[model samples]
Target: MTTRTASARYDGMGRTGKGHITTQSGILTDQYYGFNTRFEDEPGTNPEELIAAAHAACFTMALSFALERAGFRDGTLETKAAVKLEQSDGGFTITRSDLVLDASVPGISPDQFAEIAAGAKANCPVSKLLNAEITLEHHLK
Candidate 1:
């Protein structure tokens, strides 16, 4: 197990601020993300979208490995994670993360696929790390 790192910097305060985010892998090198991107839907990325990407990637990889261990090697799993950010009395909070998966696995029963997918959804590292509510909806084709 290893540690991963990312950093962000903001140049101003509140809605007028500009920020940049960078990751260890350099996938996001000085990528812009700030008030406009987050609240106003301007160009660039945001924290919620980053969380969604992380969740989707982690869950899909976990399911791929689980399927391999279950003796089903050949399949395609496409997972999309939507993270919800809500504003309430307590300020802003990430309320939920919903995962929708489209899977194509040969020679597997619907029951078995559902079971495995559920297990992956429950046990994936990102899911475990999240403090918000997590829901998984999977479609097998």
Candidate 2:
């Protein structure tokens, strides 16, 4: 079997803790302000944040493709993915993923929006990347 390696890096400057997330090219992030739970930590960006970003971007791109295929014109797409982390008997694991989508496209109703969001959530590459289970609790508000 061939092993593929992907890299993400970070440098820390003691914003409040001892670590910061460095990009793959070696750039440190400002801070990790979570949209869920509002737990502000001075430490490096946690796994959940990275997962959320991946899921959001992936779902947005997939949703865009779906909209285009459905004859919808280009428009802004905003997405949020919340990753819930929990402790298990053996160790920690990702329990659930909740996604919220908002798009500014004409001629698309709430029902259509829901369908598109569901499609994206199921087919997004990031969603497929995880071995853990994911849930698409979407709200098109």
Per-model TM-score versus the true fold: 0.97, 0.70
Error of model 2, residue 25, in angstroms: 5.4
Cα RMSD to the true fold for all candidates: 0.8, 5.6
> How accurate locally is residue 16 in candidate 2, as Cα lDDT from 0 to 100?
34
Error of 2 at 17 (Å): 12
Which clashing pairs does model 1 show? none
Candidate 2 contains a number of clashing pairs equal to: 2
- Which runs in model 2 stand beyond 4 Å of their true positions? 1-5, 8-40, 137-141
lDDT of each: 0.95, 0.70
Model 2 TM-score (2 dp)? 0.70
Q: Which residue pairs does candidate 2 place in steric collision?
A: 9-22, 10-22
- What shift in Å separates residue 107 of candidate 1 from its native position after superposition? 0.9
